[model samples]
Target: MVKEYILLIIGAVLVNNFVLSRILGICPFLGVSKRLDTAMGMGAAVIFVMTLSGFVTSWCDKYILVRYNLEYLRTIFFILVIAGLVQVVEVLLKRFSSTLYSALGIYLPLITTNCAVLGSAIICATEEEFMGRIFKSTVFCFASAVGFALALVLFSSVRERLELSKIPRSFQGPAIALVTAGILAMAFTGFAGLGS
Candidate 1:
């Protein structure tokens, strides 16, 4: 059981990273990744929202939706939950970290439609990969968020360096970021079999 969860974590975090591998949540992955602090903040928000939604959606699937044969409603339900969660995060951030809240700009609220949050919930709620392993599914979602944070932080660190370096006018911003993200994704693919 322990080894199973470990593999699950490894698969989610390193092999099938939500950002790098599945390529979900690219908005925050790119928008908030310009600075490490912002990256960390965005990561924390995603982690909280993803993990909580994963667990709740799993329960709803097992206890409510599937039981009642309402699986078709999963997408709408999941979005509602994630959007509500983002609102909570927004309120807390505004009350406590005004600077961080403003720094996130529209991207913070944009987490509502972020494919990653919805994808994580859907993966937990329906994916055959998780099946009946509810706890592991939730953990996997949480780890996916962590993996996103890890990649974002690392990318931001590198991009920070790139900013200091002189680059040609054409490849200065998003161009370089995309190229760097592609290379990082390739590096992570090398770990595909590690969980096995």
Candidate 2:
């Protein structure tokens, strides 16, 4: 059981990264890749939202969706939950960490539609192992968020360097960034063999 949960965590984090393997949240990839600092901020915000939303969504799925035959409303319900949660988090952040909230506030609103967060919730809620395993679900969400942050930070750093480096006119900016992300994905694939 321990090994199985560990594999789930590893699988979500690297072997099946939200950004790399899953191809979610490309909007942020391109939009937030200009600076490492902003990327880090966005990543932190995502991690917080995804982790908390995952736990809530999982509980809803198990107790509400499954119990009430509301499975068909999964997408609608989960996305609403995520969006609502983000709003609450944003307000809390504003009240507490004004500076940090300023850094994340702009992105927090955008995270409502971030496919990666929704995907993590849906994946964790629906997975056989995570369905009933509350702890495992929480861990999986946290792992996925960490993987996203890692991928975003690396991409941002590479993009920063790419900006300074000379490149072919045809393969600059977005094109080069896409290629870089592909390479990052390939590298992360190596983690598949670990924790198994």
Candidate 3:
């Protein structure tokens, strides 16, 4: 059980990383990664939301979706849950943490609808091995979020450096980012056997 949990964490975080391996959330990977500050903010927001949504969706999948035969509604249900959760968090941040709210202002809303967020929930729920070993919902959520944060922050740093490099005319902006992401993803391939 211990080995299983450890492998699951390692696999999810690196081998099957949201950005590098799965290629999820590429929009923000390119868009928010232009600046370290915004990228860090976005990464933090993703970590919070993904972690929260993972636990919520995992519970829903276990207690509601599977039991009620609503597995077909996974996509819609996960999206709704994530959106509502982000909205609630955003509201609370607005009232109490104005600086945080502003830092996360638009990104929060964007992540609310981010397919990557929804995808992580759905994937985590379906992976019986992951669901079975994930004793605490909070741990599952936090692990997923941490993995996402790790990928985003790493990509952001790479992109920040790429900005100062001399690239070709054709591969200037998004193209360059995409190529860089591909290389990063390739590098992450080394982690494939880590947790298996």
Candidate 4:
């Protein structure tokens, strides 16, 4: 059991990263990653919502949806669950960390519908390739969030430096950023077999 979850975590965080490899949640990935602090805030918010939604969605799928033969409703169900969970995270952040709340700006609330969060829940709950168990899904979700954070932070650091460096007039802003992202994606591809 432990080894299974360990491999799942490794796979989730490295082999199948939601952002770098799966190409999910590109909005926040580019929008908030300009600043390291904002990226961290967004990453933490995603971690909270993704992990909690993973657990909730898994339980719902197993005990409620499957029991009632309502598997078709899993998508809607997970969306509602993740949206509500994102609200909770927003509230907590507003209460405890006003600075981060302000830093996150619009991207914070955008997490409610982030495809990565929803995908994590849906994939973990329904994908036959995964364990389809609550614990494994939760672990995968957490690791995936961590992987997202890792990638975001790294990119943000490089982007920060890019801000200081001079570049040709043609490749400023998004063009350069996209080029950097391509390089990062290629680097992440090296981790392909670790999860296996």
Candidate 5:
């Protein structure tokens, strides 16, 4: 059981990374990654939202959707849960850390639509291995969120350094960033079989 959980964490965080491997939440992965502090903030927000939503959505799936045979409503239900969670995060961030909140700006609100959060909830609720198991589902969600943070932080670090590097004018902005992201994604592919 312990080994199983470890593998699950490894799988989600490395092999099936939401940002790097699955390419789910490219919006913030790119937008908020311009600065290390903002990237860290976004990663923390995503971790909070995804983990809580996984817990809530897992229970909702088991006690509400699956119990009522309303699996068809999973997507809509999950979105509502995720959106609500994002709002909570936004409020807290606004109240406690105005600087970080302002840094996040539009990207903070965009967490509502971040497929990574939604995808984590949906996966927790639907995956046979996690269905009806709130703890396991939450663990998976947390692991996936950590993966997102890891990718975001690494990318942001690289981008920060890129700010000082001299590069061809043609590849100075988004062009170079996209190329770096591709390289990062390819590097992640090396972990593909580790969890298995």
Candidate 6:
């Protein structure tokens, strides 16, 4: 059991990373990664939302949705749970970290629609290995969110460096960023078989 859990963590955090590997949260990966600080803030917020939503969505799926044969509504129900969690995160950030709050701006609220969060929740709730197991699913979600944070932080650091380096005009701005992201994604694929 311990080994299985460890492998699961390795799988989620690297082999199946929601950001780099699975490519679920490209919006924030690109939008909030301009600054390391803001990227960290967004990563922390996503970790909180994804982890909590995993717990809530798992319980709901087991005790409510699956029990009542309402599995078809999983997407809608999961979105509602994730949205509420994002709101809570937003409120807390606004009250305590005005700087990060302001920096995040639209991207912060956009967490409500971040497919990575919703994808993690859905995976936790529906994956056969995680079904009826809230703890395992929550752990998976946390690992996945950590993976997202890892990718965001690394990418932001690269982007910060890119801001200084000279490049051809045609390769500047989003063009270069996309190329960097692709290379980063390729690098992540080196971990493809690690968990196995």
lDDT of 3 by residue, 158-182 (tens): 8889889999899998888888888
Task: For candidate 2, write residues 1-196 as lDDT tens digits.
Answer: 8877778778887888889888988889779988999999999888888889888888888889989898889999999988888888888889999998987768888888688889888887776777766677888999999989888999999999999999999998788988898998898888776766
Relative to the true structure, candidate 2 reaches a TM of 0.93
Q: Which stretches of candidate 1 lie over 4 Å from their true place?
A: 88-108
List the candidates' TM-scores in order. Answer: 0.88, 0.93, 0.89, 0.89, 0.89, 0.90
Number of the predicted model whose TM-score against the real structure is largest: 2
Q: In candidate 1, residue 129 scores what lDDT?
A: 76
lDDT of 6 by residue, 88-127 (tens): 8789889998987776665657688689988988888767
Q: Which segments of candidate 6 are over 4 A away from where they belong? A: 88-108
| Superior by TM-score: candidate 2 or candidate 3 | 2
User: What digit string (tens of lDDT, one per residue) describes model 5 on residues 1-196?
Assistant: 9999999999999999899888888988888899998898888778777787888889889999999899999999888877877788789889999986776676667688678988888878767899799999999999999999999999999999999999999999999999999999999999989967
Candidate 3 or 1, higher lDDT: 1
Instruction: Write out the backbone clash pairs for model 1.
Output: none
lDDT of each: 0.84, 0.86, 0.78, 0.84, 0.88, 0.88
Candidate 3: C-alpha RMSD after superposition: 2.1
Candidate 4 lDDT by residue in tens digits, 68-143: 9898998888888778877887788889999877766666677887899888888887788653488878888899
What are the per-residue Cα lDDT tens digits for candidate 1 across 1-196?
8988888888899999988989998888888889888787788767767887788778778888888988999899878877887788789889998987776656667677689988988888777877666787789889998998899899999888998999999999999999999999999999888968
The C-alpha RMSD of each candidate to the native structure, in angstroms, is 2.7, 1.6, 2.1, 2.3, 2.5, 2.5
